[model samples]
Target: MPAQALGLPLLPPSKAKGKDFRRGVNMAITGGTAMNFSFYKSLGIENLVWNHGSLDTQIQWFKELLPSICGREQSCKGYVRKSLFMFGAYGGNDYNVQLLERGLTPEQAMNYTPKIVGAIANGVVKLIALGAVHVVVPGIFPTGCLPIFLPLFGDGDADLDDAGCLKAYNLLPPDQVPQLDAPEAGGSPPAEAPQLDEAHVRGLLRPRVPDGPGAPQVWV
Candidate 1:
């Protein structure tokens, strides 16, 4: 989700709708799909930081955007605080962590489900306190239907359900987990248990930055 990647096809603001928002030479045009590009044009995002990492790493990425939230004067561009925060589709990595790293059974990972939900909830609360007026938390997808889980957890055709997915692995839809806490803000889920005022650091969030500047931080 880099700025150049988004803006290039989006046609800046001027080229898309005949209204120029800034003064600059147009680089490329994406044909007559201008109307569909409206949302990206109006987003007015200055920077975008993205990477393939677990939920914890995503949180750190959010913090990296923190300084820009308040603007560092002559140093950094200013982005309003608490404007809109989008996080997650997490817990996928939780499964990966348990199966790949922890060597825990699916049931054991399921048992740890509550903590995972709690961490998400805590992250939401923390973001709100930090400066997020609106937070968007998306639910995880059904791993049972995914190709990865079918072979890893399934046992031949007997394990396949109506959709040819693994029934043994899919206890409940991944989206049905306890978290879906805040439906108001784009269906972001919450934690299972009440988290301490800490940043709800557990699972992935805990291992990376357990100590130092934001040590033992819990969001809500």
Candidate 2:
């Protein structure tokens, strides 16, 4: 039987004496911590695979390349009972792009986060259906710490998304730091806080998911 570590600690085989009891696969995403890699290796796992790059790339790679490799002649050729599958990453880069550059309001961003998360969860289920006996889907990191977020919220005052880079990025506290008094920060309120335009950014961060599965089609 094939075994997958999925970036988890390797466990000893049924038989000891340092003999490998089974074939193993290690799959990890880029930006995934080293601790995950170390944990798998320490358990004496040999085969390793990784997913690194943009979300689209990672998805494509998982759906295509990883499966192809695992099912190749050398990898799983003549085994009587063969199992092939993958472990996918947690988190995505779209929210950061939307918040920092596209200038989506938090409310708009929040609305999309759940959908994106749900899609990922469904992707995991699809992987399982595709002969993936085990799949590991990690969670998204707290995004308030991206370096790009620093200048966005420079004045330490709560900022609203005017659909402008300066506004949306500035809405989030830099480094996820608690909102604290910035000694001399100053910005005039524009007579009133602008109401969030829901429809404007809804399409930006999370494009309307297709009727089924394909590249995320953008309205524009």
Candidate 3:
């Protein structure tokens, strides 16, 4: 079963929480909630790469220079080289790609999101075939509640889960940028939560990115 489907907690109490540890390294997977961190640790992870915004930025940079990066690694003659097993929740920005650039309606961006999803799936499959073991793939959190999303939609009904972020707003139509960026123009107060528009709610359900740079090309 999928991790989420199996009903796993995002984070659990660590056995090392209260104990004094003088000589051990703890690899924390930071950006993530307690869910996968504890779960993966229980499965034997001592060092974490801190998978928060820092890692996300890394992934984004790599995606932008994918060809150069893949080539450099492949051509390198390293004494201890191993197949790079890369996995991530990629292509979550399709709606933004479509809405922001293509001038697609929020509804239209919804229709166009699956294209992005497929590309990410294909990339993952190729990585697996390349002999990657112990792969961990996580999906994007709700797009609607991103600081960009909440102020724009202003949907009070919207709520953030344990991660203090909404996974729902991420799905809004491409034109939703104004909604996502609405708080920026406001005089003050970072919008903690806002009511999402019908378009915003509808847009969050689907995911897609098209050819020619897709999500990575934007804001570049």
Candidate 4:
């Protein structure tokens, strides 16, 4: 469904001033990563990172805007509590940077999944600390089904699954997949805040796929 359909219109970019954020704000940037460029620098691949707008950077932007969004600490807490926070489907670009730019195989890229997930979890914890009561942190989509990966990673007929996706890359590692659902920062979410995952997102996007050859497939 469209953001407006859910009553959450597309958030304006951080730089968009004089606009109302009574709905929300968007800090995401194209080519952003879950892990910062410094992390990539540690791996000796920082040169491949074209955009420095990592999750941390976006969070900082939110922090800078928080005071203006809600004045007093107590009022800000209430504003944050009532608002829904949508964290991410984050790790995609983190892996993309490595797979497409640094030339790593899917399996090799999987090695960073844990760290990437940790970073997202940490971001959620930060949101909760800032008084978020309803935060939805979504998982990455099935990578193999993505159009970009299909052409670049497919090697032979055997690599394609019955559904026509690259079989090996269709799913995340079982252990890594559940880590996103585990307690945030080692504790359960606030009692008022229900834990949510990607399933909720899939349900929203699934119904919007039109039936036709030209219809765009919704990947969640």
Task: Report residue 20 deviation for candidate 4 (angstroms).
Answer: 1.2
Q: Compared with the true structure, what per-residue lDDT tens digits does model 3 show for residues 1-220?
A: 3636887423321223553322211222334321223433453544454224233343333333333323444442221023233244444444444444455555665554333433333343333333333234455545655676555544454455555554444444233233332222212212332233322222321122222431111110
For model 4, the superposed segments whose C-alpha errors exceed 4 Å read 48-50, 173-220
User: Candidate 3, which segments miss by more than 4 Å at Cα?
Assistant: 1-86, 103-106, 155-220
Better of 3 and 4 by lDDT: 4
Q: What local distance difference test score does each model get?
A: 0.44, 0.37, 0.37, 0.66
User: How does candidate 4 fare on TM-score?
Assistant: 0.75
lDDT of 4 by residue, 1-220 (tens): 6787987567888879798876788887777888888888777775644465888888888888888889888998888878777787687888777777788777787666656755766666566667775666667777788899888889888999898999877655222333323332233322232223333232322232234653333232
Q: For model 1, how many clashes? A: 16
Give the range of the ten consecutive residues with the poorest summed lDDT in model 1. 28-37
Best-fitting candidate, measured by lDDT? 4
The full ranking of all candidates by TM-score, starting with the best, is 4, 1, 2, 3
Candidate that would win on TM-score: 4
| Residue lDDT tens for model 2, 35-143 | 2233334535333432123333444444454433456634533331254333333433435434544466654555444334333444443443344433333334334
Whole-model alpha-carbon lDDT for candidate 4 = 0.66
Taking all chains together, each candidate's TM-score versus the true structure is 0.49, 0.40, 0.35, 0.75
Q: Which 10-residue window of candidate 3 scores lowest in summed lDDT?
A: 211-220
Model 4, C-alpha of 45: deviation from truth (Å) = 1.2
